[model samples]
Target: MILFQLSHAAEPIQVDDGYTVSKRFEKYRKLDTTISLPKLSFTEGQLVEFDLRYAQVGQRELHLDLFHAVPNKPSKGLIIFIHGGGWRAGNKSHFYPLANLLAQQGYNVALPEYRLSIAALYPAAVDDIEQATQWLLNHSSELGISTSPLIIGGGSSGGHLATLIGFKNNKQAHLLTDKPIPLYNAVINLDGLLDVTSELALKFENRKGNDSALAKWLGGRYETIPDLWHQVSPVNYINEDAPELLIISSGQARFTAGKDKTKRLFNENGRTITIIEHENIIHTFWLFEPYLTNLAADIAEFLMDVSKIEQE
Candidate 1:
């Protein structure tokens, strides 16, 4: 078992308590007796590079852990999986097990740590994630990988960021650099919100009044910054050029706001979005066994299909 910890040259910024696999597993196990936590160990014949610094914002250094097959020939493609903590809490380690599993499947997987809500807010997280992807692409040759058919994905808030990054495709000006943002060939959204401004999102996200995690991350309530809410939504950026999408929902309708609308827009442009719904499961099912193994298989299949289509 290889354990990787977040490494920082300078003292790291103290953030709020973020989500962890053990805690989440405990919470969800009671709900689903069939679920088990996946062991966070290195997969056989896979290589892991930990704490590779990607970007720096002031005193904060953003880093990512990479997992890839040992004799990584015939690599499928790069998969950047972001971690979810409602944008306030959650570290890159949350997805280490998933990354290891994907690497075992002949995919190079990256787990990046972005500035959470408590550290920055709003576009900071987005920008950090974009920079992470850009860094990976810039260093791809050195890292011994071909980044074609790049795939971006995440669970919960990470999923939302991935969707937004994939759909936006660097059309908008980046907050951190003049370098063009990398485009993704496929997006795997693991139960992330499609539109934060949707009625269902507003109700669920703001159920705690003004103290909701969404509000904290966005810097205000939807009523106060309606335009910003719309601006950050992945649904608003859909176009014919958007990457192929694969959405896996944990039987949670509230988190999937604007899914139908986004699908409708895609259909209008003669595109289709794939969705797999898991009934009677917790929101973070991707972190648990059976579900995690199943998700890795689904993602690998989807990426392979997308890559095949892209090649043709």
Candidate 2:
């Protein structure tokens, strides 16, 4: 049986704890600190923030944290963020630091948590994310965000989920909304896997042991459920409609395979896929700053460039 193990294990990894920096980011730290309730207050024409329960009534409770930065000039665009923990563990709250930083830079951000595979399964997690995007679309007027050119991104497994949402046209029945969810304008995938079947098949042959990362995520050996592996892989569903995709990988063993699969998809579809190669960052280290700073700035610049065509 596939069992999920905490990658970080016992102690949580400390990231951007402020004290480690050469110069403390006093104001940014205060603004980015994870808090029970965000303390910033702004006028209507300025940045606004809130959380919304986007899941269906009487269903599992899911809350999405949103950050809106009203542009001094007409707004640029809105972006949604998904957190990655191999679809087992991760809280949207702890990831607020990323959202805060982006919001401060004039892009509205939404961070949502889906029911993990351990709690649910295949389409359930995808459904939760799709619903969050749908809810954002419905509330665009109230939230002060435009529906066009909405960008979606995340690191690691979140990157996988973001790509699935961006590439899959016929979303399965589970992620039901009254209407189709608005497709993403662009996607930022940070070290996310694309094809589980090929990856697992290779890993299994290598006898790398049950230490298979995705096997743990799927709750069993990939060999047992070959069909499920193909079904969930984003590479299987890519087509011309797949949004512009930006992939970043640290050239790790697990990630290189995914990058190859993604490149193959892009080649077959005649789409331009950009990859921001990193020096030696690990799976999800793109979420940390300094190391993340260059990528974040690139992302911010990319989104702004995309927004120029749609800006108010």
Candidate 3:
């Protein structure tokens, strides 16, 4: 077992937000420092390949946890799933259960670990996601994955990065230069905030307290680094060529600015925009029981229809 010691930054900056970097790390550490192990065994001929490094950030290596369909069956496409922790904390390991379900349905899913805000700032995680996808594409043949189409999805803050990565090439590269990104067949968002330009995000709230995730991830408030905020939001990059979207939310757009633009653009372009909302449930409710099974099915059906991927 590779022990990843995730600790708080020594005297870490708290910015205007009340929560200090050290505190965020502390909260995550209490949750667990490693990936959650698979509690349930697979019986549907599913296969899981663990711990393949897809990229590296300085000395800290980034890896992916993979799930595949029936052995030897070529998958319709590969999915790169990101986990959410308000951009501060989360692990790819917590996703094995869901990955198993998708694998059993015949889709190859890759859960990639990206640099968290505690480790790096805004675009570092973004760049890492791009790198992970490129690495998977590079090794697709050997891994029995097809490159014609790819799916990217995540919940909460993870959903933000997933959607941000799909914007036009060079739109978000940390190096300010982007390599070619694959044409995504679909984009999935589970209550991700797509716009950071809102006055509510940029101004209204105090520079402290629980709403510190975004400011922390961006290195400062939106007013201080407006460009960074603009770059990280996916809503600004919408176009007629954008892929179909599967938006699962309990009303995330109403809170995040520019999200309406995303919905509007998809509708204007005649793209297949499927939104499934569960009323009276909390945000990120799909993560809990009584909602997981139905959510999983919704994802499967959406990917299959859009990508022509099949369930075995």
Candidate 4:
């Protein structure tokens, strides 16, 4: 197995964002003994490419990790998986295991790192992801993948970003380029909020005053920036043009606010929306074993189904 590391001096100390693998494991282990942190190991046929710079925001260079097979053969399409840290924490490495597993299953996986709330605000991460999707699309041929069924997906905050990118398909004012935003064929949201302006979402996000992660990411509380709150909510963008959706929930209703409305909108447009619910599981269940494996398998199945439908 070959490994490429991101070229950087001594890694900086990670901030206490209250979102980390070790912390999530510690908190969830008591609830379910079957859960285990996924061990990172590359299969013989896997190709892992690390730290490919996709875009630059001033002095900060954004990078992505690509995972696929040795002699790559496109299966469904390329999947760009974003990491969730409430828009403030989490890194691309958080999705490494899932990307690896998905790559081994005959799909090209790109895990991109965007500017966090600490470095930038609201639309920064969204623009970064939009650029990342365009980067993958521009290099799809050389990378040995088809962009016909390109999929956007992520967990928690990442999931919200993915859904927003898929639904909002418009250039943001913060984007550095005038290029059209890349459109996705489907979305795989893993326990991400559909509506940030929901009563439940506001209850939790505004509970800590302006110190909440959501408030920091959005630049203010719902009361202060009601327009921004609604602007970022994926639920508000649902329409006939929206792509197919697969929502995998961890039985947390707060994270799934507006999910019913989203489903109804999709149904009204005759669009496909598949929902897989895992009761009694933690919010970050996609990062661990058992749940991780199941999540990957479900994603694979969804991709295959979407591909078949597209072909027909």
Clashes of each: 0, 2, 5, 0
lDDT of 2 by residue, 116-229 (tens): 755665677788888888898888897768666777888777887888777774333225566565666778887777776675445743364344545655555666767766
TM-score of each: 0.92, 0.75, 0.79, 0.90
Residue-level lDDT of model 1, residues 81-193, one tens digit each, is 98898888888888888888888777889999898888787899988888998899889989987677688999999999999998887334344366666767888899999
lDDT of 4 by residue, 195-229 (tens): 88888888888779799888899899989889998
How would you encode candidate 3's per-residue C-alpha lDDT over 1-312 as one tens digit per residue? 122343422323222222233444455444434312224458656678888888755557778988877564556677788888778776776566677777766788899988777768878888888888889988988987665557888877888788877655423333343455566767888877777676555443236633568887888876577787787778877776566688888653443445667778878876677877656354544444345566778898887678433311
Report residue 298 deviation for candidate 4 (angstroms). Answer: 0.8
Against the reference, the lDDT scores of all candidates come to: 0.82, 0.65, 0.68, 0.82
lDDT of 3 at 79: 78
Q: State the TM-score for model 3.
A: 0.79
Show where candidate 1 strays beyond 4 Å. Answer: 1-12, 40-44, 70-73, 170-178, 307-312
How far does residue 58 in candidate 1 sit from its true spot (Å)? Answer: 1.0
Quote the lDDT for 146 in model 4: 63
How far in Å is the alpha carbon of 276 misplaced in model 4?
0.8
Predicted structure 4: clash tally = 0
